[model samples]
Target: MKINPKNGVDQLVFGMKQNHVENLYGTPDKQFKDEDGNVIYLYNKEKLRLTFYEDEALRLGYIITSNSEATLLDQKVIGKNIVEIKTELPFKSWEQEDFDSTENHFNESNWLILQSEFDVIIRVEIGAIINDNDEFDWKFKA
Candidate 1:
């Protein structure tokens, strides 16, 4: 699903496969396949560390800071709900545009548009899970 930053609406939808990571974000710098056949890819860019994983069938992705104390910072910053995090640090219009451009090229279940102060906007999506859980689970479906 693609989101409209100007409005809180879902714009488009597409299908994706289990090995579609590169198609979505190009090749990753480091790739690790666990003993259980789960794959994890790491992409390092400036202050950001993008981690993509197919853990047991669930497609889990996250981004974190790459500062010297990144591990400590991650422990403090990771796993917060979007609403809680966004309330403290509102997204800007330019960021929304960047997000829209990046995410629209990929496949998602459903997308959402969120507005903030200064007319800023953000697009969010419920991504797929590639793990070994129940196949019919709709947890990520928006």
Candidate 2:
């Protein structure tokens, strides 16, 4: 499914209440707080993470996952190679960071900061993605 700001990433979006999410997906497998004070709901079995803001109401902040349905620009990203993703998404510009592949982790891992028309910064990891507000300073930090 195409990622929509109103509909949210995959199944949830910002401004959605925590209870509404619980009702839709049932209780999360586990929950934890991130260093940024966001509440992260982890469904390990599904490889999904729903993060909520630190407000008392717990509004959805972002969604991080490797779910097959969590797509951007019509690309079915889960399990897809980075090359395939690069082909499907029309990223205006990007910043890439490479990770050293070790003996224990032989796969070549990298991070791509995909800047899109949606005005969101998509952090594309080797096997997962983190979609959040574009706090990237386009003029200075890019």
lDDT of all predictions, in order shown?
Answer: 0.33, 0.51
Q: What value does the lDDT take at residue 94 in candidate 1? A: 21
Which whole-number lDDT from 0 to 100 does residue 113 have in model 1? 26
Q: Which parts of model 1 are misplaced by more than 4 Å?
A: 1-19, 46-142
Tell me the spans in candidate 2 whose CA falls farther than 4 Å from its real position: 5-7, 55-57, 102-142
Model 2 per-residue lDDT at 116: 24
Q: Give the C-alpha lDDT of model 1.
A: 0.33
lDDT of 1 by residue, 104-139 (tens): 211222222222233322222233333357442322
Cα distance off (Å), candidate 1, residue 35? 4.1
